[model samples]
Target: MRHLKGGPEPDKHMLRRELLAVRNGLTTDDVREAATGLAQHALQLPELAHARTVAAYVSVGSEPGTLALLDALRERGVRVLLPALLPDNDLDWGAYAGEGSLARIQHGGRMALFEPVGERLGPDAVTDADVVLLPGLAVDARGMRLGRGGGSYDRVLARLERAGARPTLVVLLYDAEVVERVPEEAHDRPVHAVVTPSGVRRFS
Candidate 1:
């Protein structure tokens, strides 16, 4: 696969639109097949194997599916923490009890999200996680991730850093989403690995 070269720079907004179009184009069968494969590959990660607590999210729209992995982790007795979006776009933590424990929430004009309906554990709760499964549009060879522009995960990363948390950071995406490079800014940091339906890639 051709990696992106550092030069005049690519338009992130345009790139996002293009990627989203591809994602939205996936058929229901395509998404389900990928989701099953994604769960298989993600569960093989050594980080997850040793993790007692994992911070993850529920997939919405065409995002790479995570429900299978979440259920598997929960069944293993691992503490699975889900996020609830704050008005400021930051996140608060909540424990995932099961499918019955989630509540659909509509934040303004955004699509409804399935959030945990348990006690609000506050933002700092994520610091206790051993692994954090991030949601993104793409990740470059350098492991720098391109998010959906909401900036919620950015704050989460910052909080983890401030607390000196060394949780293994992982992003979930389609195989095509792993590119040679993507646009970057000062605050951007590389993820430790990415899990696709095809397999997993790790970075130093």
Candidate 2:
């Protein structure tokens, strides 16, 4: 996708309205079923299937399915790393060996996360990553991501750009969460592809 330095500021009110519309449209059972199907497709992706190391997020909110995918990756012998929210609102990645191995760490406000194992690293870790599954509030066909207004992934992905490496960025979303356009900002990062229960699609 062509990189644009700045675009119209996303209409926060409109965005919220759109998000609520999507949220209200789906039942909890619908989300679970979609997530399960998406997880299966993710495991079948050639890159992910053969990847030695992968970077993923621990799902929060009403995003798509991830727990099963994490387990599947582990079963395939892929080294999985999860992002832990840090004190400064930056992200640090660590290995997700298992639930028993994860320690509770403070995250985004009062939220607690299972801290991954080993030394914390930045997005340069994406250099060796075969796959990086991103969490998004919504994603458009152009790969634009509407995050939770945190700008955490944007900052990290920009750092990756400075290092001259672009790992495959995949956004995991429920089918309905995929939209025609998600408002973008000057600092927003674009993903390479989006995966849903139906299948994977190149965003650009």
Q: Among these predicted structures, which one has the highest lDDT?
A: 1
Candidate 2: residue 170 lDDT (0-100): 87
Query: Model 1 off-target regions past 4 Å?
Result: 1-8
Model 2: pairs clashing at backbone N, Cα or C within 3 Å: none
Residue 3, candidate 1: C-alpha displacement in angstroms: 6.1
Question: How well is each residue in 36-145 modelled by candidate 2, as lDDT tens digits?
Answer: 99898887777787788888877644567687898889988998888877667777788877766677766546556666766777646655677788887677767888
Each prediction's RMSD over C-alphas, in Å, is 1.6, 4.6
TM-score, per-candidate, Cα-based: 0.96, 0.83
Reference-based TM-score, model 2: 0.83
- How far in Å is the alpha carbon of 35 misplaced in model 1? 0.6
Q: Mind giving the per-residue lDDT tens digits that candidate 1 earns over 89-170? A: 9999999999899999999998899999999999999999999999999999889999999999999999999999999999
